[model samples]
Target chain A: MKEEIQDNLIQIHDLRISIYSEGSYFDVVKGLSLSVCSNEILCLVGESGCGKSITALSVMGLLPTDVAQVTNGEILFRGQDLLKLSASDMRRLRSDEISMIFQDPITSLDPVFTIGSLLTEIIRVHRNVGSSEAENMAVDALEAAQLPNARQRLKSYPHELSGGMRQRVMIALATALNPAVLIADEPTTALDVTVQAQILERLRERQREQKMGMLLITHDLAVVAEVADRVAVMYAGEIVEEASVQTLFDKPQHPYTQGLLGAIPDITARRGSLHAIPGRVPPPQVPPPGCEFAPRCVHALEECWESRPLLEGSGEGKLRCFNPQPLIT
Target chain B: MLIVLLISSVAVFYAIRLSGGDATAAALPGSATEEFREEFRARIGLDKPIYLQYFAYMGKILKGDPGHSITNNASLVEMLKEHGKNSLVLGGAAFALVFLIGVPLGVLASLRRNSWADHGIMSFSIAGMAIPNFWLALLAIWLFASTFRILPAAGCCSGKQLILPAIVLAFEGIALTVRMTRSAMIENQNNDFVRTLRAGGLSEWRVMGKHVLRNAMIPIISLAGLRIGQIVGYALIVEQIFSWPGIGQALVTAVLRRDYPVAQFFSLVLVVLVVLGNWLADTGYTLANPRLRRSR
Candidate 1:
């Protein structure tokens, strides 16, 4: 509701998304909140089960209707609550304004359709275009993604292409509409380090070309380092720290952030046992009552276990901690 | 492609000759003798050695001059040309029905897994698989003709009469397609692509249609192809029960009357249809499965 920027493309506020299954039970995504500004890459960094992907799916309105429920949330995209839109309207927004590229390339595409068929299907559906025109657009998209033999590759099936090539094709499909926002959920997780780099480069190039705002979700800190302009560190379905990529790397604030940075094997640091956060992340079903990361925080005070920490701050960074790290400014 | 067709044709010819030899050995009391064999051989260009006969038969067939039926004295090629269209129409219509109804129902069942709709489809599928085609045809006759007086029990020529027989034929096809489709869909529902499609802002129905449904239907298409031959086989029985004047009925009449040429020609026709069905299935498999093209 509080969209501060006049040029902001997406504004999400106190987005409390919870997936209820069976009887009125299990809230998978517990009161998560995040935002991505236009033309900026916001990396939603979290371990598995921290509701990173849930938040992304909520934005897309693609969650399974049966087991998943957005109990409460405000996913404001360009001053409209996407959750309240009609299914048709939501669909219109999905492939046009917001698109997503998933992690695994091998399984993301339909094995039965040629890349051309898949591309043309999407292109034709979203635009009033002829098959030939759509195909030409697809070829252009493929070339833009740095894929070789755009014409021949279009005729080929997903399996015929290499892992990197498949990912590139995925990028092409995602960006074909020149979507204003692209949500890439662990897009390079399934590839080799080299292929991952190539996929990332291709995606980055496409993103730059379209000047599209991107929400890059990944658990890999290295990946976050490689592409993220800003990073939001999620813990137990809550963002514990959010800051500029440079600020998060050079001056991590929250204790969890510090612990995460310390845990990274630093060749420059002495070869002692690497620092690690002691406990595992709490399960979503029965997350700790107070700050979700408190139990694992070495600096946990008496009150830390009794009250939840609100994500707060401005300018340089934000940290959700009872014992907040002072901002130098 | 032509070579494979030739080889398959030769294999079928040999199979028929072997079966025919067994019949000749028994030489049913009313049947003709060596005189008949000589006549049949000369008629079929089979007086020559097996290999030569194979080439001659194939060469003639290629030239659209397939030999005459030994029983009815009808041209084998001409008979197929006359009746093949009807069989194909029935087969194609049945296939369409199965796909149109079965696939969507299968997908719905998968989407609403464990729901009443799923339960209904699954139960129907089981019953369809369990009941024999002849029995199903009889039941269809009783239900549509005897009981409801809504449709003719047999002899479908007009598009209107096609409804009952087509539905009867499609019972098994639907069962096979639905069951396979449901199982395949359930399997594909677990695939990462479905998950990815969902993650990519695709609706459940769209994900099911574009990703899960197509992947699931791949196996079904092959099964359906194989079943088309089976349907052709079953068509004979159904045609007999319904008194429909299809190729199957003609073949049965030939067999009963000991019309050797007619029986031989019908058998060959069936074999060719089976082969063509298999070939069509292969091409379909190639087209449906991007994995094949992708692998290439």
Candidate 2:
């Protein structure tokens, strides 16, 4: 077992996951490698069902039973292989060492529980604290997440709060123990434009204060542009490209990445038609073997349809393509 | 306060109308003279205006003496109290039986949606829905009382006897509850929050228990509330059929003899039970939904 034992907070090697459907197993995430350093944000950008959220869920060991299964892979956290850990041990590690905030806050929280109960449950489970003290800490965490009226709001139920407030409460619950890593899976997908911005901003603020590593899975490129330090472009359950955000945006090497960038509508651009990807993201059940995006690639070559490209580093960026898109002059 | 009073007065008016004003005030076909009828009307305070009579009845009811039965001389309040207890016991037991069996089965079927387990449970639910209550009650009596002779067939007593009637009473409720729970569970399974909880590192049990069950229960609570009155009403029929000396059997006796006061009192008790059931359901719903509290 090769263990990269430096400052890496999380490291995954040769992780392979398959889903059971219709009496057959289909590979959802092929052999994939990823690393997240402490106090950094890694963004996974892709269209829907690209295995980005699946990868994040795998790291938390939260894959649903009867469908998704981690067949092969080793998720190492703090020099310990997560898959090998006992369920009892992993339960302790989940909310304390690595926490997660979901996409929709409205439904994520229990309707019967007050915000105070929800927040305090996490605190009491992970921390050896009394209820009164835990409640005070929960309120502080909520305030840290920038929720107004933290004291009064704690008494309110999740439905009593606005969408934005509920999201903040979720953040507060996830961060009450100051976990080392936070996985936010499409955290702003359900919110309005303005609320989305506020939630992202709150997440970034909390990440910086806690100096916690974050694996943010999202389909929205704008969100990634605003928050990511490194961006991994996923296409049909594979990371086609990985590079620093500035490098990926400044000089996109993958045709899929370029297509995504092109698809982003700019409000300031004048007299220009909005660009769209030619077709929808292909369903994962029968993903094309050779380059999944070859069918949609404007710059596709014959080799792209015959041979799949392994992720190879060329200069400052890595891309999995036979012929990476050339830099625009 | 005004609404409650207005509603009470309306109920009273309807009750009086249904009983044909006052039987004693009208002259008897063969025995009573006009002078005797007029004197009896004055004695009973029926000679006064309807509105004044209403106030006097309301006063007596509030003071806990709901007047005496015209035929039996039994106090309406006492009769209601005795019969209401039996009804409550039967209804409560039936409810317990229905929910205890229904909820878990519904949840299991939902979790294993489209599986054989789901199909079997649904078939049972359908059977429960199709079977009529009276027939089921009679069947219970025949099987337990007449055929095997293990139970007495009717009356609120310990043994195999209560089982059949309770089961018969609960069968439809269980069916309703199971269908509701299964559908609610199915709906909750697809909720984004449930997905989110699963993604948030919760195990399947935790997700279902904490998120799915709680949310799914909201609708079930409302359904239970609406069904409570019906269940109690059904208890009356079941009790009469089974010779269970409960409210319904007593009601039949009172109604058959045209004991107007006793009948009216029993009806009022039922209405009160229904209203109270509704109130409890509302409170339960509010407790389950945070959005409701915030809106209020």
Candidate 3:
């Protein structure tokens, strides 16, 4: 890890999210915290059903209140607690200081509206501009996102474009206002592998150019390796490790983090029989009493089964484990 | 679409024949001799074979003759034209009222979701659907005309008279529209685009009115064709109850008088209009839903 400014752009502190049904509440995200500094990409890596997407949704204030709610925690952006703000006030801050793009572009853009309308409307909402001026700004944003023939694509609806092109349009819409934070919830997961690389590269380029703090959520280890400046590994509902990407991958300490790295196929050496972590993520409704990932960890200790580990350590990274192990490398 | 119209014409011809009454005999006055009636039937081509009679009916419609009335022997064209205008005005007003109330209420219900406002709107629409139109018409008349003495109980005149009939005409339609709009809006509120729009910083109103409602319109517009057929059918029934003198009223009178040509012509025209409406709805559907347009 290099010595950097460390000026955090967005901070989630002790956040807990829960889903409610039939008069009973089940917590899905339990007391988790992480940060993204300006000009950095923080990849939230986890297996499916690990509450990664819900955490990202909470940050953007997009959680459906009837289904899920942020029961605890503060999402601090620009020194303001987002959860405490009124809905209207939060809306004004959205797409201006914070924006989001989703995993599937096809379903994320309004099918009845043109790309031009979708993009320009967002700009007009945040800024006082005439339609023509907004249109020009939208065009420039699309061009900045590396969409070819950007001006003409404006009239096209979402379905008229290919998946890659639509994703590019989504990137264009999200970044057009130059928000301080961008929460991308697996933006390229629905795209082709080739398009995935291109989209990730484009996002990195945008993050660098805008000096934006990006919270990139993904389950793919390769994506985390390619794009993350920092990595946070979540299991069940809690973040188990937070560190600079190099340290998390090269000197992983937590057993779950080690398992994730091991699970990644070795493309270079062409290893046969891929490795997998034992057991699946426990359903959030009935999370284990002690360490949530203890059942899946190969090096679990008796202490790990008796009590949960708090996120500890400093400097290069932090690990939440009673018995943190050093990698052989 | 054209094939549907042609088939509809054949159905109309047989429907009139199988109606269990002799139209030509009904057309003749009681004082006429049996010889004169026979001569009149032969002159009008009614004495021809069944297929020939079908061809003759089609020919009359194509020639724009419209045949004649059974009771008064008046020109069917002029009567239809007048009645058509009245029904159009009444139907258009009812259509506008249904949308005006249904859309905003549905949106409010969906946005409020499980709130009192949501329950109120849903319960009101259900009640509207449960009550029959004739019963509603009678109740509205009693309330507005008899109890309040502010409007007429029967007959079409004044904007006030138009109100009760239109309300009766719009009741089920309004109920349908509200339910459709509510379900579609609720479905769309959970849609990806709506989430994207909301996350993009647009105001809640803008998201609901623009993004959610806009996508929901595809189904609503598709419903228009079926609605128009229903609206027209509803208007006819409503008109008879109110003595509104609309086309539906005229058709009812013609049917009772055994005015076969007049009745058949009106049904055929209605069929054509419905088919045309459905065809137009396809275009409307394409406009509202861009995905269908792109696939072509």
Give the C-alpha lDDT of model 2. Answer: 0.81
Ranking of candidates on TM-score, top first: 3, 2, 1
Candidate 2 residue A44 Cα shift, in angstroms, is 1.4
Question: Runs in model 1 with CA error above 4 Å?
Answer: A1-3, A21-24, A114-117, A120-124, A127-140, A148-156, A201-211, A268-274, A324-329, B1-101, B104-118, B155-163, B185-216
Deviation (Å) of B272 in candidate 1: 3.0
Which candidate, 1 or 2, would have the higher TM-score against the true structure? 2
Per-residue lDDT of A100 in model 3: 93
Q: What's each prediction's clash count?
A: 5, 0, 0
Could you report the Cα RMSD, in angstroms, for every candidate shown? 4.8, 4.0, 2.2
Tens-digit lDDT track of model 2 for B1-296: 34654596568556654666455633244477878888877887778887787777778777888887767688877877787777767778888988999999999999889999999999999999998899988887788789989878776766455777778889999998999999998898877666545433456687787778988999898767777877878877888888776777787776666565666667666667677778778887877665675576
CA deviation > 4 Å runs, candidate 2: A1-4, A19-28, A79-87, A192-198, A264-269, A283-286, A314-316, B1-65, B108-121, B156-164, B195-206
Under CAPRI classification, how is model 1 graded?
Answer: acceptable
Which pairs in model 1 have colliding backbones?
A: A160-B294, B69-B261, B70-B261, B71-B261, B71-B262
Minimal lDDT window, size 10, model 3 chain A? A1-10
Model 1 chain B: weakest 10-residue lDDT segment is: B21-30
Taking the tens digit of each residue's C-alpha lDDT, what string does model 3 give over B1-296? 98999998999888887887766667887888888987887876778987899988788778988787767877889888888888888888888888888888888888888999999999999998999898898888889888999988877667877888988898888888999998998898888888889888998889988888988888988887777777887877899999998888888888888887778888887787778878888888887888888785
Q: What is the TM-score, restricted to chain A, for candidate 3?
A: 0.96
Candidate 3 per-residue lDDT, tens place, A1-329, comes to 23332477787899999999778899989999888889989999998888999998898888888799999989888668989989999898888889898999988988889999999999999999999999999999999999999999999988888999999999999999999899999999999999999999999999999999999999998999999999999988899998999888788988889888887777787657888887888887677878998888778889988999998877558788998887753
Encode model 1's per-residue lDDT on B157-198: one tens digit a residue: 778677777777778778877877888988988777765555
